[model samples]
Target chain A: MNIPLNITKTIHDWLFSIMPEGVATVTEWVIVAAAYLALFAVAGLYLVLLERKVAAWFQLRLGPNRVGPWGIFQTMADALKLVSKELTSNANIDKFLYNLAPYFVILSSLIAIGVFPFSRQFQALDINIGIFFLFAVSSIGVIGILLAGWSSNNKFAMIGAMRSGLQTISYELSVGLSMLTMVLLTGSLQLSEIIEVQRTGGWLILQGHIPAIIAFMIFMIAGTAETNRAPFDLVEAESELGAGFHTEYSGMKFAYFFLAEFINMFIIASIAVVLFFGGWLSPFGITDDITWFPETIWFVIKVLGIIFLMMWFRWTFPRLRVDQLLTLEWKYLLPINLVNLVLMAIIIWLNWTI
Target chain B: MSYFSDIYNGIKTLLTGMSVTGGYFIRARKGSITQQYPDNRETLKMFDRFRGEVVMPHNENNEHYCTGCQACEIACPNGSIEIVWDRQVDPETGKKKKMIDKHIYHLGMCTMCSLCVEACPTDAIVWAQNYENSVYDRKYLTKVLNQPGSKVKAGIED
Candidate 1:
């Protein structure tokens, strides 16, 4: 009756029982890595399909519905096409870095995903400074983008890479500050601990009140910019820069960049889920007595809701100008985020949280 | 201050835009205007004036409205229409009459301009709404409008 199912823990224990301690730990790590890799790949493909479907609905159109039932296999067909496509690139391109760039982008996202607490006791990695680790790993993707552009030997790619770097760096501040505001309320950087705090206190958004809402808004805007999606998508403005940093890439290399993007979106949405929406906690304990309904389902539902919001933002808002993007960060979001953080700290000091 | 007001206005406008899209998203099932092209072929209706292609209608008696006047041939800008004709002896009148041997239409060359249909004095040619015009061979596009042994309708010339 306490939602007493911890499947991941049982699996961990069973693995240890069958092997020596060190070997068991190594095997567990391998299994977790493989599971996460599979999850990331599938999630990326489905997220792409979801984005297209949502975009169609917004524009009063019918999206892809031919390849499979309701077009479920459309992205799978796209993956096959990309795989069969020839890997074409300029002869003057730096071969080593050009080949290495996509892995950097994809690997960073995969690493960031490992720390997410999908449900109680379901996290692969539970590091003490989990949020900080996420921030650090997520930024490594920009290095990959920069390397790709520099090695591509194309002017547009170079300009796009520069824009991406500028955008990521500027928005990273607001993202961190907004998150730091919530860290004050929960008093921990570890994701699981943050969620555990929420289990009793209700969602952080409700507990911290006005400042929490402000931080949530700022976080969403900055998170969207960090992912380099539309509205802040100056990095690959097709009308201006022509496919951006991945301009010279083709076949699976281009697929890597594209997949990394959606995975990064999932990561951001997951973080928002953990920090503000009580991670896997059922709302108001309405279904606490129902043992059949798992906490992981609740977690996934929250993440998807946030992902839909981000997609809505992408389809609704026009891409911001480069200067306007910078102004929004420096002139508006940064100041507001900093003030919101302090207000959160003050509210915490006075024991004013609900 | 204007600075705070700007922030407030920006947030308001963004929410307003989101609400519009959200409203559509909720009603998206009923609101979508897309026509499933191949699937709805049975129920699909083309407009009355849609000039998909040119066709010559034949009556049950194998008689058509064309008088072999060659007006459509001359009116066609692309020369898509060709009328091959011969002077045949009319047994009833005991006189020579212009009759069509072949009424060739080159669908490949046609721009669907409807000029030939407009030029026909006897309303012989009209637009057909069949849009699936693809063919594996170019020869398939060149169609003869009049069937074999078909003759001009009685009193059509007068």
Candidate 2:
């Protein structure tokens, strides 16, 4: 069933009624931005805690249990510690670019969070070019990483930044092509429209059959690489580069880079949710009759599932060597992605989509 | 065909790896092998042969088997054991005999080699199972093993 409540729209109309149009719109923008900032900050912290706990379980160890029940407050305490720490850096660093780098990384993820259709009528920016906008903003984050590396005046950081640039550029093609393959089935780049199409035609993974599944596999791999996660984490290869590009960053500045990574992972997982799994659309409409169970919950559940899957990849696979990383992208993922895109187009053309 | 087969085998191995971790995750609550140290102190038991520290055993009458022979003192590699002795008249036998004034043990220098325990012909010293041996003062590590006013067991041969 469709979302019964339009809480965001109701609040918008109420604000416009009491104030002038310009004032109301600006006020609404401020509120939405503030809300998204809070949402992502908390989500990033908990995702870190979740990663530690999941890793512990996989290794058959008890994770953080010292803080508030089951170590819920461990990340909170860590964030506090990071905040109070002194912001130390090398004296030889470029002041302008060094200061600007973290904002570039964090703001891009926050902006991308705005376009997601959390539930019906709950989207902040329902732009027609939603998928393109996400891709554009996500690519901007690598510029931040590059700048952080270059400005730090450290060789290890510089090497990490270079690796990040190479990895992201290679993976972006597969990420785009895989999404493009799914776009062939839905015929729209707008995320809300994509979900709406899935609502009527069943999930794209089932409808488009083998090609869709192939696209999904490629998308997950590319998406993980895009976020600079493990197995593809040559960017900050702890063993080789010693924390990669942000080695010189300390205190809250380092935290900004750390938080941005988790938020980027969320964004990638959200995109996967919107495309492959039906975004906010219940499976077979089982819970459609229960109006109290919101569509937003369903959207969150799917996003978290994809995030967990990514985490599983992180803890399971070993990091790829620099050359192997390149070979995998160019020889393996890219070729498969291109053929899958063509296959999806043919499936749609011949009315063979399930 | 080999290229596709390589990809197939790679994915297969990866899945096998995931299954192993996933199985551990499923049984995580019971499978965790972490020993919460201080919390489990009541239940913690060291093996019988664990050489934690050296102790001189005393019987109910506060009498020990040591004849003040100083074999353990010579056998100790690091000079961890020292025995002070003086000749005294045996009350029952009315003859002069060697007796220990103090049996000093320096826990700090002891290497836990069990050599001193083995050198004792009378089996006076044995290894204690208590591993928590830390003390705030270095002086506390220098222990006097013999009790105050305690004597050697009657009829013990040197």
Residues A1-354 of candidate 1 have per-residue lDDT tens digits of 223245666877899899999999999888888998899989999999999999999888899889899999999999999999999989899999999999999999999999988777667889999999999999999999999999999999999999999999999999999999999999999998998898899999999999999999999999999999988889989999899999999999999999999999999999999999999899997777787777888889999999999999998999999999999999999999988988998999999999
What TM-score quantifies how close candidate 1 is to the native fold? Answer: 0.91
- Per-candidate DockQ vs. reference: 0.70, 0.60
Interface RMSD of each: 0.8, 1.0
RMSD per candidate (Å) reads 2.6, 4.0
lDDT of each: 0.92, 0.92
Runs of candidate 2 with Cα error greater than 4 angstroms are A1-10, A17-19, B40-157
What residue runs in model 1 are displaced by over 4 Å at the alpha carbon?
A1-6, A21-23, B40-47, B60-63, B68-70, B73-106, B136-155
Model 2, position A87, has a per-residue lDDT of 90
How do the residues A1-354 of candidate 2 rate in per-residue lDDT, one tens digit apiece?
A: 344355676788899999999999999999988888889899999999999999898888999988999899999999999999999878999999999999999989989999999888678899999999999999999999999999999999999999999999999999999999998899999999999999889999999899999999999999999999998998899999999999999999999999999999999999999999999889998887887778988999999999989988998899999899999999999999988988888889999988
| Model number with the top TM-score | 1
Per-residue accuracy of model 1 over B55-90 as CA lDDT, tens digit each: 999999999999999999999998999999999987
